[model samples]
Target: MTAVVSNSTEYLLGQSLSSRDDDNHNIYTNLLYLDTSSPGFNDPITFPKDPKERENLLELPGNRKVLIAQPAVVTDVGDNIRHYTLDCHGFQYVNHTTKCSKEMFLDETMIKASYYPEVDQLIKDVTGASYVHLFDYAARGPLNGDDGDPKINRPVKSVHCDQSYEGAKRVVMSRLPDKAFAEEVVENRRFQIMNIWRPLEPIYKDPFAVTDARSIPDSDLVALPVIAGDYTEESWAAEPNSAHRWYFKFAQKPDEVLMFKCFDLVRKRMSPVEYFMLRLRTGLKSICPHDKALRSELVWFTVNSSSNQIHDRYL
Candidate 1:
């Protein structure tokens, strides 16, 4: 019998946020719950009974249906972990935002100038990428949880305290703040930023990959091949003569596992200017310190840049 393989996002939803088992049994530290009014939800679908057959893509869990069901409703997410449910039709904005911020080690600031270098160094330590992508914002209300054209997920500003670095304040939005006369017009921008605006569609493609298969049952190794196809083929795309490719040198070992860590720079979604700005942040030596109020403004500025860039390409 084939064991059921869960998507990363779904697996993450099921994780017990406090379990401290071995690497094979660690639990998440957070939980995400969806409001009952969400159109993107439905009864949980059980896995196939077969033990040997790999799960089909459609049969695997996702949030597609939740959005389809409540195309234009406000999605409410509670902070408590026990109330969280992994069973749903489509992914929720609250879920994605919570996950991304957590993954990036970001608080509300999204771009905490003080911790910018530390964030980069951490990523560099792990990924060995000297540079990391960062953005600043003034205010991110739209993405936070504002309701709008039911169909639109406006960007929302998250808040985080800058540790010790000094820089600009709040993120800014170029256009008018969401005029949410009604829930439909509230605009789900935060969802767009967290869910969309990514080089990859549904950035949470397998939100549960690291937490679930790896930390859950020991049987995930058998399911790796199943989850492998869930990722875009572009993840493995190689272009010769391209500046994006990173060649690695590996030492031969009798039985050691040689892991090749490479960044697949395909599907770049940033504008050249945005890319340059990202590069500039790493080299900037002159730093400007701002209070929470001012930092809030800077956050808005970065959000405006992100929104403008996303609109240029998508809207």
Candidate 2:
């Protein structure tokens, strides 16, 4: 299939927001090309087997909306094209009591702390966002990471600190509907992304819905970079060769690539410049009323000691 950006500008703007076709949903879908040779490649791999399977597991109701999702080419992990299972969950230890594990919880803390003035200021003092935007700093993504391979099924553990991270913090915003009808809509798009990961139940014909889609803002979903790994084993260096189940790992092609897939609307929430810089270390200068270089209004940092990686993400 042609790369998403290869399509015409007109096609992009007119692209359907509702989940219907893979072409339309490709925007946010993980880019992992499946390796059919792997066992259970055609079947869904369930571990703890989430009852809901994953929340709002489908599209939401709304008027037609348009967002741009451009394809970006970056250097691969190495020489070989590492194949990865898209959307595998990665967990990390923060405090003795509060262990942050899932993607939903991680996204929530990022949105609360990263978007606030105080946290933004701290980021500014470290990274110069004007030039280099941090796309996904030390924040975690939706359960993405190499836990090993489905062929080996090795259990892993990990511990992390904030200093050894590279990605930037990003704030994601979505106006997708939250009604019963939204489930069907999302499922339609999910099919386009990956039939491997779907809700346990079929779409709810009369599910409850959220009326205010705009209530959730981009800053409400923030994340940072991290050096994550299992303590018992070498998380980054080990090969994923489990016996039967599928786990996160790169293809053996030498170029280790991370596989990811998401819906069209989900793609839009993550592809912006401002959202990219929230996680990097940038240098910030106190605003001078007369300075015209400030891209936004001068806002003071709000100190938030309540914030900690206890619930932060580093995927």
Where's the lowest-lDDT run of ten residues in candidate 1? 280-289
- Count of backbone collisions in candidate 1: 80
State TM-scores per candidate: 0.20, 0.18
**RMSD to the native, candidate 1?**
21.7
lDDT of 1 by residue, 1-315 (tens): 000111122322112222223432222222221233454343332224353332242456632222111111111122322222111111111111111332232244434644455433332332233223344322212222234322222221110112101111111121224334212211221111111111111211111110110111211111101122222111110111111111100111111111111111112237754321211111000001111111111211112112111111111
lDDT of 1 at 41: 40
Question: Which digits, one per residue and each the tens of the lDDT, describe model 2 over residues 1-315?
Answer: 011111112322112222223432112111112233444332321222242332222222211112222221111122221221121111111111112222322243543444333333332332222111121222211122223322111111111111111111111111122344334333221111100111112211110000011222222221212112211111011111111111111111111111121111221225543222122111100000110010111112111111112222212
Assess candidate 2 and give its lDDT: 0.18
Best by lDDT: 1
CA lDDT for candidate 1 = 0.19
Residue range with the least summed lDDT across 10 consecutive positions in model 2? 283-292
- In model 2, the runs with Cα more than 4 Å from the true position are 1-33, 47-110, 113-177, 180-261, 265-315
